[model samples]
Target chain A: MKPDAPVLQTSGLSIGYAGTALYEHLELKLFPGTLTCLLGLNGSGKSTLLRTLCRLQPALGGQIELLGKPLQRYSPQALAQTVGVVLTKKHYAGDLTAYDLVALGRHPHTGFFGSLRSSDRALIEQALEAVGMASASSHRLARLSDGERQKIMIAKAIAQQCPIIMLDEPTAFLDVISRIETLMLLRKLAREHQRAILLSTHDVEHAIRTVDTFWMLRRGCRPVCGTPEDLILGGAMASLFEKNGFTFDPLSEHRAIAEHARPVGIEGDPAIAVWVNNALIRTGRKPSPIAPSYPCINCMGKNRFTVGMPNGACKNVSSVSELLTLLHEAESMPAQPILPRYA
Target chain B: MRAGLYPILVVLMLLLFAACLVYGSVFIPFDAVIKILAGKAVERTAWQSIVLQSRLPQAATAVLAGSALAVSGLLLQTFFRNPLAGPSILGISDGANLGVAAVILLAGNPGQYFLGGYWAVIPAAFAGAGGVMALIIYFSAKVRNSVMLLIIGIMIGYLASSAISVLNYYATADRVHSYVMWGMGNFSSISLERLPLFAVCTVVGLAFSVMLIKPLNALLLGETYAANLGVNVRSVRMQILLCTGFLAAVTTAFCGPVSFIGLAVPHVARLLLGSSNHRQLLPVTLLAGACVALLCNLLMVVPGAGTVLPLNAVTPWVGAPIIIYVIASKKHIHYFNEA
Candidate 1:
């Protein structure tokens, strides 16, 4: 019960089903006040591991201790009181109001009739407030969008008042904005509420940017757990999906860039040069400082770019779209002097 | 809204109950019926008999059968997470039918030895329904998918029905005729002497359902989420099966395979309450079921037309439209999705 003690710990754990193990001899820890993301390729046992840790599924050969008690030793009610889980299953929330759904999180805490007491009601409202969904308390779930429903679900978990919280791909069906919002919410809960939060998601970029720790899983390999930077620098992220011919380059932009490009030299403000480099790569041209003989695009420091032609003609464009059009026109007519597409 | 609606439902149920007593084929006056019910003497003793022995018991049967069937339907629908699931849809009533068929057609008149034929048929119906319920529960454990479990229940019902068909095909013509008559369903089948047993059985089944309000509400979130909420999913499923099984069996034993009430009434309650929280939904469904059943009973006697329509015939008129509305407006209902 010490403040600094890890709320959840696993040692020599093996997880799987039907007598086969997906992972074996694994060691993991989740401390209070930190967020951990379980990242893995599909069918790489991310769900199996999470389900096992939550005691939804049994572990193959290891012990999971939550709050200093072995997971198997806790009954379902006791486990519910200690660990709150938000599964990825699409439950029927259509008939429940936002308040009703959040109140369901008090299942283990309520009386047999499930009548909420004064304290329980306050907790439900506070939980809804925490997720910024207090205003939607009386609205039926069918009226809300998927993102709103997801927030309500998180509110349900928060109302559970457990020391540890776990979610399974909570952002899977959410839009980008909601995804970031949910991640930020989880991070905030971990830091401010001092709860140990864990989630499994395929959103690798967001996971790296938001989570405090990563549990990277790959088939036939022991899970590698560490801070995001440590894992990235150690090349564990790269090896996760290496077998599928997918490479994870932390330094490169997440969007795919062309392999073959016409080299161009650029010199300008560093801020403008960065976007100019993006524009050149997107237009199938490589921007480099030393390629002085190639057609050079000069960055003019305020969303302006000057394309210098080999024939000593120059054209300036104000926006990236105009720059792309000018680059395309210039590339299509290399034998002619570059026309000023955008004055 | 619930506060206003519940009182309205109670009043409607009372009106229907009064209407059932006053407007039967005999056409007893409302005042005389009230006087007879209040234990006052009436001029025509036959009028007293008709009011007390006949319409009173019939109305009470309708109330019990309606609530029992409706609550059974609600439990199955919530357990399966399918709006279409109900006692008849899952073949549980057919199991009862097959049981009664075996007892009446095959048992060679156990009524003669048991003082009344129902003494054997009631238990037989429970056994047959319980057998099918056990089969459905077994398959539910084996199959994780609700739709699949539902299909298996239907298949099991078909098997029981085929067995009943064979029994019908070879039985004596008189026995076959009686079995067919029972199959049409009648609320007047239970006499005043037998009403207490029926009431007790239905009440027990309903009590079980009441005890399940919390778990039933949890189940609306689907089994995994319910389990995460510390609900013992396996035990709850078993309890639901037992409760629905007992309710379906008891009603089917006395009323024949009463149609549509079990399948359609929960949706009526849901639509009326505009929510599926079982604490509210279960009681509202019970009251709505009784109201519909009483209304159907009143509609059965065409006000001295001298022809009493069968209960099953009257139920579809009330139950089918609601079901059709539910299907046509499936998106608006937002009950549950197959996925």
Candidate 2:
């Protein structure tokens, strides 16, 4: 649990699939007792990174060291006892109960011919309870929903008693509530169990709130590693999206498509044009007949309300940055604002 | 440790052993038969030899062959992770049949065929069985999944059967009849002379299976997990194939290829034990199979007066239903562990 003790390390690593290189010349270290999240676009190498670290998939180059020794040096059994993986689910051929599947975690602990001891059973039950699946222990896997199935898979990994656990896209198939709950459980595991937990997720908000390290894979090369705050402050958030219509929003940490990006001019008289422009931007359609009765608009700079294009064609205003600055100033006054849905 | 299973097996074996003694063309007195078995002088000479030699060994062969085949079946089913896998599934029995056919028909001299006389069939059948095992082991290693390996085995069996058909086509009429009779399967085909080899192979095969008990228990979690638990998947696989093939070849060589017991007895054993852990399942399967075979041998006896029926005919009646029940039952299906 020491900060310097490495749970998993890759040196000069290159990983690929079916002979095509995904990444090369990569060096990374995952520390114990911390939850790390990998954030990336759809085709980014998050899964490849996790797989290569665990040695599940063959690393195309370099070596993976676990506890200061080469990964392949450990026997499969010994390595399995140290690291537990919750892989994406596929076909599991049986009517095994949740408890029965979880009990399989004890396989690495028991003797080749040994019976399940009391300790093994206790661990299985505890893991079941860890995921809030204690009462549903007897339910067959065939009867469980997607959320419940994810919990069972996680519970099984917990029972394995490994010091390091890694998951790939664990929240991909979950609903919003289940996604939050899964991240919370993982956070608890990182804190209480003192196990290094690494997970890949596309849910940006959950990753920001729950994880200790955000491995941002924005540039599609060697991932940039830092705290969530560092990632946002370093302008890494701005390049997260490459699509033609969208741009990353710093304040909300979201993607948005810009419209009516006209700049306001003729400020003066206590920035009256800025105030009216801010009001128009709020409705996103146009200002609801800018209240002529309001004194805020009394000191108008333009010739009796210089009419501009409603569609934000910028028939008058030059740049959208000016309009955004005005809105930022007005929004700071009193009312707590609501961001747009797409933004 | 169930009170019911062991007693049932014991009683069935005993009743069948008793019935075999009293059964023959002529009515032999029960008291006289018992006295003869105990070394009391019998008044009749021909009947004495028939009871002591023909009937006793036939009954013994039935038990031995049945137990070996059933245990082999259980091991293969578990190894392949398929309910349908058995000795025949891998073409081990077909290879034995081909060996027997080559000796009886295709070979120039009938004496050289079983060569060294009746002693030759064991080595001949073993070599044939060994060939088939090599194919199965090759397939198991190359194929990643259990079901795919199973299909590979089926294809191998088809090739063996086809090879057998060609041999049958070219064989002379008299040799063809012998081959056909061997195909029908009969325990009485094992004479008193070959009993020692049969017993030896069965014991050796059974002993080899004991080494697998630990790996078998680990396998219930599936192969990758089993390997993760330090079980060497390839070595264990090789050992299973050799043991299962040897047991089947010896039985098929000596007793005309007994059927169904291997495929069915394991299910009954699993149902009785209620756990797939091989430590419990293996012994129960061997014992259950022996008892079933012994009982069938007893049934073939017409109770104090009749000729013995072929064991193959009686085994199917006992075996086929259990197999059907295992396959057709949807609720209790379990996939055996494979690495």
Candidate 3:
């Protein structure tokens, strides 16, 4: 975390839809420069938590504060300047271009007439650049693909120049590559801009690999908050799955069932990614679409493919003696692709 | 004027105004018509009175009513965020109708209804308009969604119409006849004596509209986004409801429920501006509205005639096609940011 004030906090808060209570007695704080991934199963109050913090769906009990100011204490204009929200719902209703949409972030600072001042335009351009959307700056909101649209939305929030950016399931409609790219962009924002990027995403592996901290919510349980390593190492990841059938493999440090887990190996560098992918398929592993993002080598064929192992040794392998070492490295880095080997 | 909107509107309005000045229910030569306007000697007393008194007021009334209705329609469309929403849906004008109904039917007996004197028409209209405005404001406060409010407004209009029907059913034949004439809708109903009051009310409503131009732009972004931008959403909605009600009520009181312009002109204006910026939208709405109403009024002259189309019939023909065009075109203009 960047030594800054907390960007989002809930003090013993209860949240709900208009008249119905969904969750209560919740307290949390997210500091600047920390990418917090909020997770929960459906109906576990994930969206409810976000809405309360955003102060859109008002809290029925306790208070939510941003930057130490009670959420309601800040005027709408003041709050807009301090906090930018990207809801998963709306893209844009108006026939505005990408520049127009991003420039809307400056709406808080711009006069009621809402003109584009030079500084405002420059900041808008900068935000687009930050989101890697500079090339698409002139695109209309309706004309872009889902991932591009999400980036544009974040670009708009950045244009507001708020310290805290809260997004609710921003990757919901994006394709896998777009989702990972968006997550990477968010991490970049947190690391480089020192802005808090708190987002709720259904992409669990992506979140685990990219975000600094986790806010995990399960039905009938208090939200579990901790660093990703703590949550994974402390056997918290096992509880996230079914206890009877699904189990965490300590040797591999991955979430899987012991009965179905299998080993398949190939030789040579750069073939590891494809070897593991084909092996997982051979073993009837579901092969979640996101498992192959990292490049890997196969010892037998000396070919490369992007395939990070779920629970296996993967690194440089001169001989089968180094198989365990590669698995440990793969688990530790999570981003590393598991290489094919024989020990 | 970029699309030649302002110029087209000005030239069209000027030519129509001139036509109204020259041709009328009574035939007058072009030379005499030009001479009368130039303050030269004219031969005919009746022609002078018809041209100077009847046609001039009528033309002025068409311009005023048309502009007011167009701007009001534009405001309501933006406020409700619905293509179908319009000023008449609120029944505010119908509320004025009921008020005028009461004055015409139940106020006194037959010919003596005018016994309230020439002063009665303007005050009665203002009161009726004020009454409807109050009702719409109250309903607006109760409803949260603009779409819901629009539906409720339609229901209110039906209720007002029913009430007017009941009043007509019970009134004497003479009162019924006069009320029916009133409902036909007229451009020359505002006499020279009553011009100042009508002018004052319309100007005040239009001025209020100008003040609202800023908030109206924010509102086009949708409610939550607008609130995020520090717009007092509830208060803005209330103010809009009041403005719509007031404008509709005033125009209705004087023009006898002038329809179509309130609903279609805004869509036309939006097409003209090609953007949602209210700064441009509001003026375009005003000019287009004035042109439409004045042209429709000019249609009444029919080259050498005074028999105008019933305002409601002509308005639907003019208003419906524009509305259809907007909807058909809407499918083509993609909403880019709908994530």
Best candidate according to DockQ: 1
lDDT of each: 0.86, 0.73, 0.72
- Residue-by-residue lDDT tens digits, candidate 2, A183-250: 99999998998888889988887788889998777434567888887877786755565443444445
Instruction: Give the residue spans of candidate 1 off by over 4 A.
Output: A253-298, A301-303, A306-343, B110-115, B337-339
Find the candidate with the highest lDDT and give its number: 1
Q: Taking the candidates in order, what DockQ does each have?
A: 0.57, 0.17, 0.38
Deviating ranges (above 4 Å) for candidate 3? A1-3, A17-21, A91-94, A132-140, A241-343, B1-15, B30-35, B38-41, B45-47, B108-146, B333-339
- Docking category for candidate 1? medium
Poorest stretch of ten by lDDT in candidate 2 chain A: A290-299
Please estimate how well model 2 matches the true structure, expressed as its whole-model Cα lDDT: 0.73
Mind giving the per-residue lDDT tens digits that candidate 3 earns over A290-323?
3333223354533322223544434454443354
Clash number by candidate, in order:
0, 5, 27
